[model samples]
Target: MMNKTNKILIQWLSWPIHVRIALIVILLILFFGELISVIEPKEFPTAFDGIWWAIVTVSTVGFGDSTPKTHAGKLVGMVTILIGASFAASYFAILSAATFQKQQAYVDGEIPFKRKNHVVIIGWNEKAHEMIQSLRAVKPFKQIVLIDHSLKEAPLMENVHFIRGNPTNDFTLLKANVKEADAAIITADQHKNELDADMQSVLVLLALKGINPSLYCVIEILTEHQANNAKRAGADEIIKTYQLTSHFIMSSYLAKNGLSTIYSKLNPATGNSFQVLPVPENLVGKTFKEASIHLLDQESILLGIKREEEAKMNPPLSYEILAGDYLIVFSH
Candidate 1:
């Protein structure tokens, strides 16, 4: 009979997590209430008063409104104080740990099977961080999943999900929900040599496309030659980082050392932000000068139009706007 009861107790303990917690909590309250009621029957004239005192003690409220008066009752209260403190603290600690465990699971990339239409950024670096910051400024609510191996803890930031693993692994991409991602960005490793980093980006791009052929993917190529490789790996856009920066930096000398001003003016974070909005349908067939004139009323200065494959900057006044073209405007 003892062995059968022992087996039953083990089975009860092995129940599901919520059930176990419920059972433990219920036991904590009931056993303490029954102990106090039996110790001093007058203090707790009824079971309800016993339960009430137990709840007040265990919750750390200690209202002292219905506390015991007799010596045995006081001893029971002292026992409640000792055990209740630990139970009360452990109760909250368990709750906090459970919440933290869920967050840690997300960091380990264990429970992102439902993440869809979110941005997947592979390879965290300076540029990748800047991209994330820019994204936050532009779209405060956009979901961005950061995949990296070096981070020990998930970034404690809102709208940012963390996945810790090798960026080139298809399994890691799967954990990031690449198959349903809205877009994917691959940044080269700033710590490695340019050639090695660019090749790594290419490899990551290949894995991304392999998992989701239709997912829009943009990759950074540190070396000019690796741009071709990245493109061949099915990258929708290959950003030649060194090449673009070098040209842009050199071009600024033409403005008499106005590089800082030029960069600030072009960057959205510095107040002189550039934005691309859909051109009004009524202005589709209108000339650039006419569109600019009308756009002045909206407090936006038309800089150019983004047509198929490229942007036309400072085009002739007679240039006709095409349908489906985006207007590049400057907003202060």
Candidate 2:
């Protein structure tokens, strides 16, 4: 039984730092009492008497259960009291520090995008790279940040920053600055089950709304039901990827035209290929004809106009440009 007790004491000593520190302090008081008894037998006549005295003094119980009789013994008891107080204070300090670190990490994870100036990406996946490429083509100079955990690289672009954590984490949402983003594009990560992707997209939308009530949020969904859910999550726009892909594919098949052109333009090998240019707010009063002339001069073709709530593909030359219109231009 004595050996067993020794083994248990050793095991406790080997525990984590905080645990060991606490144990060491308790043992220190015990050892001090025992040593005093051995050197000055009058201080503690027996092991039971020494332990009883320690318990009463350290606990401030002062039960009068046992009392140190020698001057040396009383001094040892005083030292034990100080040690116990110090250990209690240190324990609380360590616990408070740990708690603060957890709270700080949560704050860092919230979406950081703000200012109606940065690109806000919601979901993360293999396709995220391609989506980012598209955004780059449209707004090469804009700041782009990604919000997702699965991505080891949230913002792969040189000017981009990554949230580097889960989208649902509130801190992750604030870190992305969801409120100040120029536009938020939520895409589903590539997954075998389309439903899972849709759910993630919806979750991102919900997180964004909680952070910024007025922030523009776009979500991608695989099904109609998912789309409805995304809308309920406060998404301003929800794109049904499969449905749109089917439409595009069917149209391409009927026309006997391959999607290669569409693919290459959106996924250009050259960095200088297809691009999206936001019309200068100052140029909003200009007619589309003027914008077309400017684009042609730059050796680019104007494909369409993207406004606050409307995307007009292949708008007429006479169409009037607005302050926030994003002109879709294709260049070499």
Candidate 2 Cα outliers beyond 4 Å, as residue runs? 1-116, 153-156, 266-332
- Model 2 lDDT tens row, 117-234: 7887766665667778776766687787877666543343566666767777777666676667777788877753788878777877787788888888777788788888887788
For model 1, the run of ten residues with the poorest summed lDDT: 262-271
Question: In model 1, what lDDT does residue 100 have?
Answer: 92
Q: Provide the lDDT at 78 for model 2.
A: 76
* Best TM-score among the predictions, by candidate number: 1
lDDT of 1 by residue, 55-147 (tens): 898778889888888888888877877877666777677778888988679766565656688999887777777778877877788899999
Cα error, residue 98 of model 2, in Å, equals: 20
TM-score of 2: 0.48
